[model samples]
Target: MAETLRNTLKAERERLDLTQAALAERVGVSRKTINTVENGVFVPSTILALKLATALDRPVEALFQLDDSGVSPKQDT
Candidate 1:
């Protein structure tokens, strides 16, 4: 079984009226980094995730979650 990583970074960032570039600056990353994460092309590191959560005034869990939809049940032999 496999788990997926999901996030609400764009929504939260927008709620705070922040542009991707602005949020990136706040979190010490590049705008492309933020875009990548928002678009699910990249997974941020623990430090980056925490920094984003803090900058957006949200908890880390609120920003990211483990999605189990990708999990598959074991098949009997």
Candidate 2:
């Protein structure tokens, strides 16, 4: 099985005019974590994902996507 993870964290936050610090405060994470997430350098855990979704007022699926592309090519195809 393969998975692809896509996040709209930065876009959504920007759309709402939220700074990374503000988002981190709302999500109970450090600003560095939010920065890492926005930069695609971190893949959040389920709990963190839920917190982000809650803070953004969006469903988890809207913020994250799991698809074939997330896996290695050997696993995906």
Candidate 3:
């Protein structure tokens, strides 16, 4: 099984009525970085994740979760 990092970045940013650029500026990152992170194109480092959580006033776990749907059980040979 694989644990993928799924996030609620888009939803959280929207809930705060913040544009990608605005959120990026607040987190000292570029808008592309925010977009990539939100769209799951990029996996943010722990530092970036913490910064995002802090800027959004959300807990790290609230922003991200581990999804195990990427793999399936092994079949008997």
Tens digits of lDDT, candidate 2, 1-77: 53447688999999899999999999888999999987777889999999998888999989887656546566554
- Lowest lDDT 10-residue stretch of candidate 2: 68-77
**Candidate 3 Cα errors over 4 Å, as ranges:** 70-77
Estimate the TM-score for candidate 2.
Answer: 0.79
Between candidates 1 and 3, which one is better according to TM-score?
A: 1
Q: Please, what are the lDDT tens digits per residue for candidate 1 over residues 1-77?
A: 75568999999999999999999999999999999999888989999999999999999999999786866677999
Best by TM-score: 1
Local accuracy by lDDT, each model: 0.93, 0.86, 0.93
RMSD of 3: 4.5
Estimate the overall C-alpha local distance difference test score of candidate 2.
0.86
Worst 10 residues of 3 by lDDT: 65-74
lDDT: the better of candidates 2 and 3: 3
lDDT of 1 at 27: 90
RMSD per model, one decimal? 4.0, 4.5, 4.5
lDDT of 1: 0.93
Candidate 3 lDDT score relative to the true structure? 0.93
